[model samples]
Target chain A: MMEFINFYLIPGLVLGSIYALGAIGITLTFSILRFANFAHGETMLLGVYITYSLVQFSGVHPLIALPFGALLTVIVVLGIDRAFYKPFRNSPTIMVVIASFGMMLMVRSMVQFIWGVQLKGMTQGIQRPMIFFDSLRISPKHITIIGAAIVLMLAVHYLLSRTKIGKAMRAMSDSPELAKLTGIDTEKVVRMTWIVGGALATAAGVFLAIDTHIDTNMGFKMLLPMFAAAILGGIGRPFGAVAGGLVIGIVEEISSYPWIGVEPLLNPGYKAGVAFAIMIGMLLWRPSGLFKGKVF
Target chain B: MSNSELQTVLELDQIIGGYGDTQILHGVSMRVDPGEIVVIIGPNGAGKSTAMKAVFGLLNLSGGKVRLNGEDITNMPPDQVVHHGVCYVPQTSNIFPSLTVEENLEMGAFVRTDDFRPRLQELYDIFPPLAEKRRQAAGTLSGGQRQMVAMAKAMMLEPQILLLDEPTAGLSPKYRGEIFAIVKTVNATGTPILMVEQNAKQALKIANRGYVLVDGKNKFEGSGHDLLEDAEVAEMFLGGGAPP
Candidate 1:
């Protein structure tokens, strides 16, 4: 039981936090901009590589390079929005979707062109784990991932509930025409959405790279889990994505353990399958998602 | 004839426009003054709502200009209309359905930089039902309550002139009466209004003046009682009933 708690539960929580960070971006983009934003995973990949380069240039720790990387990612994604997505905003929905898929490929190839295809570890050494209560061990990297996710989520919550721009974003999401009638500056709100979504995606990438490995394929690999979590929780719900991410992460980890009589039927390799299963279950039971979010 | 040109709060002078090249409102002109309720009644496709939209700058106008007070505000975007002390309450999608009643009110004052508390208090006092359910989502409210919320939100801006498109649309008779009573009380606060209403007979009762529009043209313009009593106006539009 002790081994199970330490190995599966703690690790699951870390993985869940990473997934939550990514899904928040997805949900916000879907809500404010009204698109699936398939390039979100690639955006995270760009963030991780930027953090890697920042760490190398400044010789700073991954944790220290995080904010800079996130800020740069925000700038990059905002530029991307202005260049590519803004022009086609009023176009057909499927056109924007196809554009995003193309953008996903575009971003992936850019990372490959610059950083090459080799996998890279964020930190130099095999860092020691921090010991908690009896037989409970966790790494500093995992602790950072969990802490960062919590802090970012709290900041986002405060922004959404207590700020004017946040209120405008929600209002626009509810009804764009009504929002315009109410005198909300829709363009400013759109730019703010990109900033928030970009920063969250960056944090997700940086933490993910630190915990596992940094590579061009990192974001692509996370695509299924992040999207599944977003869909399962609620397409346009930020907090719901957090809940969905934790569920997917824990399920994926626990399914790999020998819980049912000795040997486990599901392997850790079936982590992707766990996300698919949960997403399908949510779709079957409540298509609006757990929080009654936007169905599309 | 009701309010002179200088006293008029809003004037739509020979307004002509529609979606794309199809003109819905042709040479439709109307005006409302300070502290007056001017109601527009017409058939389903008679451009009553289009006139309101053109005045509120929801779409482009092919001809004619809208004057607020005395300033020409022709074809200004909807966002800028509220700044000129004019606000619009859409017939539908009036309130942010998912937002709480309080949030809807807050959004109503979105463009204002000054304090909104004074007007908010006044609105709550006027609509005590809204005040009691301030935390409830506007979507969850009954049809009458939702109309009240919509009216209350537009009132939050404290506009000198309020433009309403079918405020009592699709409401029960009891709710309709309640909305008219509220509208009467709202007009008492020095705000003039131009509204399109479906219940022609009931709406004209409280209206200071009324316009009968047919095919986007003004068929009859008279004092509320005169139009209510005019045989031709009644036979053609008001369903041949006594003004109740």
Candidate 2:
């Protein structure tokens, strides 16, 4: 049990926190914009690279450098939205979806060109885990990631529930035509969606980087699981996305947990398959998902 | 009455519009004077709702003018139209399904920078059922209650004029009568109402004046009482029966 907690459960939760953050952006964009934003993973990658450069230059902790990275990422995302996605706002959703796919390639190439496809570490040396109760182990960085994720999640909850603009955002998501009739500025709501999505994507990328090394493909690799998380939680529900993320994360880790014997139950090599299976199963059975989100 | 008091609050002049080259409203014109309930009663495809959309700028107008307080607001988008003190409750999908009733009202006052709590309270007082279910999702309400939520949402802005497109379209007889009473109560508060109603008799009973539209043109325009008593209107529109 101690080995499972230390080796599988703790790592799964750390990964889940990162996925939950990234999935929030995916779910928001899918809901409000009414499009599958294929370029979202690239946005996360861009934030990670920016954070990497900031840490290298200022010698600050990744957490300290995260806000700057997120801000810069937001600027870049807003620019991309204006240049590529804005023209397709009134066009068919497919047009914007294809545009996002093109953007994914363009952004990935740009990151490779600037960062040279090299693996970079956000922190210099690895610190050992802090043992609690002589058997369980928890890393200080993991604690920080989980704590920060909780704070951000609470902030998002407050924004969506309490603030005027947040309420307008929810209103727009619920019914865009009624929202327009009610005098809510659609463009302003769209802009706010991007800002929130971009910031959360940056936080997700930074958290992942703190856990593992950053590479050009890191965001792309995590993209599938994050999408699975979003779909599992429900297309537009932020809280559902968090729950889906945690479930996917824990399941992926536990799938290889040697539950039957000591031979590694599913041979950790195929862990990514778990998310895909769950996602496909959800799409087949419950397209509205656990939170009863929008079907489309 | 003084000249300013008699001024029209909302005027639709020679409005011609429709979706994608199929013209619906052909030179439709209507007006709502201050402190009046104006109903436009017409058969299907007579462009009654289209005229309302024209006033709200929900469609493209090839020719016409919408004036609010004598200011030309022709072809203004729906969001901008709300700022000009004209609120419209659509026939269907008027309330955000997922938003709570109070949140729907909040979005109604999205343009206002000042406090709207008093107006909200006033609306709650007018629509008592909505006040009890203020926190419930608007979609979960019955058809009649949803219509109440829709009207209350439009009233949140306290507009100079209110346009309701078939407010009681799908309600039962009991709820429909209740809605008519609610309309009269709302009108008593001095907000001029321009409504398109299928229940022509009940609507005209509450309306100060009414218009009879046929094929997108005004067939008749008179005081509600006069129109109700008109022999031809009674034969064609009032179900071929004597005036009740």
In terms of DockQ, the best-performing candidate is: 2
Q: Model 2: runs farther than 4 Å from truth?
A: B1-6
lDDT of 1 by residue, A81-138 (tens): 9999999988987888899999999999999999999989888889798887857788
- Candidate with maximal lDDT: 2
Candidates' TM-scores?
A: 0.96, 0.97
DockQ of 1: 0.75
Error of 1 at A219 (Å): 1.7
Q: Each candidate's chain B TM-score?
A: 0.97, 0.96
Q: How much DockQ does model 2 earn?
A: 0.85
Q: Mind giving the per-residue lDDT tens digits that candidate 2 earns over A1-296?
A: 99999999989998888889999999999999999998899999999999889988999989999999999999999999899899999899999999999999999999999999878888879889999999989999999999999999999999999999888888888888888888999889999999999999999999998999888998788889999999999998999999999999999999999899678899898999999999999999998889998888
Please provide the root mean square deviation of candidate 2 (C-alpha atoms, Å). Answer: 1.6
Query: lDDT per model, in order?
Result: 0.88, 0.91
DockQ of each: 0.75, 0.85
Q: What's the CA RMSD for each of the models?
A: 1.7, 1.6
Please give the lDDT score at residue B216 for candidate 2.
84
